[model samples]
Target: MWLDAVDGYRHLTPESLKAAMPRCPRPVAWARALDDAIEFWGVTDIAMLLAQVGHESADLTRLVESLHYSAERLMAVWPSRFETYARASQFAGYPEKLANEVYGGRLGNIEPGDGWRFRGRGPLQLTGRYNYTAFATAIDDDAPIKTPQLVAEPIYGALSACWYFVTRVTPRASIEVATREINGGLIGLADRRRRYEQASRALEA
Candidate 1:
């Protein structure tokens, strides 16, 4: 069903993807998963899809969200809450601690460690326990809710990202809108647009 809808990348093969990005070659499995997920999610904007994955996952090299920050960095991320959360107020503290303080008890996080446990994962960088639960429900899997880290896998990561695009981003068809939805703002708008253009040309060729 999904493959039928993926007209743009219907002919996209692993060899072609490798050719497109020589610096970061993707395996056959990555190609298969990416193609299937894109097809399954019914995405038409190949450029946006490709660009998003490249930017979010660093061309699919990283799946886990790196939150490691010093107290000053943490304050920068959360100007109002740093003092509230960090007791010492010297070092911003560990990534896990910052995640817990910022993400805890919100976005569907119920338990004590829900924040760090369900931190961003996968090519799309899905974050928050609530969003993870939503993805799990959409796919009819409880594993993501129980162990959100599974979304970091290429197949699942690609699938979740596709889902997000189809549901939250496809309607707008604008990289700016998608960026705001994915990153919660226009943090990397310039880079995202650049990646989209690069992918559009590469995929077109």
Candidate 2:
């Protein structure tokens, strides 16, 4: 099928994708979307892309970013913003407030409520109005800006994830470089590498 057309992705059949991401609800759709994205973006490293997507979306189970965090977690995640437990407790368990506090005043989210409005979405967790606007412009579609939730849809999610991978991270970059590009750091790096190895094995099998 579509996987056959991808230069180095011939072994990534729908069945292998399912094996790599057992929790994904629509393996076929994901395969088709990935095929289209690889062609559209000239992606060369399918395994790295799959690993990043799987890690970002929790094996394709989470399409939206979950901001819910406890005080301790908030402090840990945003040490600068939530310098202390008392400061973190203010926005603890409040996703909207947490998003606004951390994401507002930057990333083209000047307007009030823009933080939560543009919270991470899609398989790659596209965040910020800047990225949303940029992706919309790249795809020549205003829908991503007007209806950002559309990024959560399977086709759009996969496409957006691929776009990020191709544009931000080189197609053939190492998994470490790709992870840094997508995550802005080495967060969950061990898990990401594990997932990458699993996807590689599944696709190669």
Best by TM-score: 2
lDDT over C-alpha atoms for residue 128 of model 1 = 91
> In candidate 1, which residue ranges exceed 4 Å CA deviation?
1-11, 19-25, 84-93
Q: Model 1 — which ten-residue stretch has the worst lDDT?
A: 1-10
CA lDDT, every prediction?
A: 0.74, 0.84
Off by over 4 Å in 2: 1-12
Cα shift from native, residue 77, model 2 (Å): 1.5
Residue 73 in candidate 1 has what lDDT?
66
- Give a tens-digit lDDT track for model 2, residues 1-205: 2233444433356788898888889888787777677777777878898889998898888999889999999878788888888899999889998888899999999889989999999999999999999998988888888998989987678778889988889657777888899888998899889988888888878
RMSD list, candidates in order: 3.4, 3.5
lDDT of 1 by residue, 130-203 (tens): 88988888877788888777788767877898898787774646888888877778877888898888776777
